[model samples]
Target: MSVGVRRVAKGVGDFVIEALGEAVGEFVLSLLACALLGCLVLVAYLAWSFSPRLTIAGAGVLGLLLAHGAWQTFRTSTKGRRRGLATLTAAAFGATAITAIFLLLYGTGCDCW
Candidate 1:
């Protein structure tokens, strides 16, 4: 209604908009970084999968990386329940990856039957 009141409201609106924009930007950047990292992992997996000698070692390293990433994520997470769940999921995935590597190495020849 009043000129002063209108100005104050406009300033507050601008501040809120700027803050939201920043939050969204951060979220987008994080997503992009995750996507890039996933791509790198996929490339590494492909490269290793093609080589019989490197497959086991590569998978083991990847599993370790996953576990470490999970630990870091858990440490940084703000929500307790989500942190616990994410950590558990990461651990499970890492364990499965490592187990698969071992199985692959122990099972029949690298060449498909």
Candidate 2:
């Protein structure tokens, strides 16, 4: 094989590896993901902290996020998903959100908890 072809193949391989590792980290550290992570951490802390109102507000924020995700999954321009799959995924998210709210309202009543 030519040296140029060999170098190109090596470069592509390196890019793929970096994409699987460093690129993912870069994206996670990017503004949007970083801000969302910060919000999630704050919500978690609020839910665990010394006030019932904060915990309730944290759950409300989570419910809002579920609604946003569900809306995103349904919005054609934003979601970029096909109709059938989008409906299926939206339904799944709705089910998951319902189950989560139910659990939040009522304990499992198990000793493990």
Candidate 3:
């Protein structure tokens, strides 16, 4: 190949590599953010739903969410295999986090509207 063609090919290859690296970095960051959100949600739910008599069901749900968040963190760190499971866990965590946040914000307050 001509020198100019070789240089162009090399530039394109570098661009593709950099883009892939950025994408992977963004994915990992997103996963971490989701995990944090899940943790926050679990905490909020436990706090909000706590009663003077201590409800067992509320505690159980909090435990489940906490365990799921931990499991997702494990799967995400071991990224060599089980990509499908990791993705599902991350998505679930994000959805649960959003739900919990909304519930905490709106479920208790009535006159804030």
Candidate 4:
């Protein structure tokens, strides 16, 4: 094979390897994020189901904060990466947080006597 052809072949191989590396990295990151989100959701559910009114409020606030952080992370992720999946997960979490906040408000019934 010609030297030019050999160089091109090696370049293609290197590009493939780099792309695979990026894919693996993104996969791992997404998995970790999902695992963490699951744990948070579990804890939030427990709090919402069993806690006192004041404690439920605290948990609601915490969930909202975490969701906001996830949204920011999603938005700041660069293009051509796993940003789309991460953004979707963030949206799910954001919606959950908003729902929880709404439930909290509804349960508390903000009224001045």
Q: What are the per-residue Cα lDDT tens digits for candidate 2 across 39-106?
A: 65687776677787878877786566667668866566754654765566567677776755644443
Error of 2 at 104 (Å): 14
Give a tens-digit lDDT track for model 1, residues 1-113. 99999999999999999999999976665555455455657887788779967887777876776776567555755655555556666777666666556445433232222
Backbone clashes per model, in order? 0, 0, 0, 0
Candidate 3 per-residue lDDT, tens place, 1-113, comes to 99999999999999999999999976665555566556766876776677623555666765676567657755546445546655566566777667767555544432322
Candidate 1 lDDT (Cα, 0 to 1): 0.66
What local distance difference test score does each model get? 0.66, 0.64, 0.65, 0.66
Model 1: CA > 4 A from native: 52-113
Off by over 4 Å in 2: 1-49, 78-113
Highest TM-score among the candidates is held by which one?
4
| lDDT tens per residue, model 4, 1-113 | 99999999999999999999999976665555555556766886787778679677786775676666576655655554555555565666777667557445442342311
- The better-scoring model by lDDT among 3 and 4 is 4
Q: lDDT value for candidate 3?
A: 0.65
* Model 3, runs deviating above 4 Å: 51-113
State each model's C-alpha RMSD to the native.
14.4, 12.2, 13.0, 16.2
lDDT of 2 at 100: 51
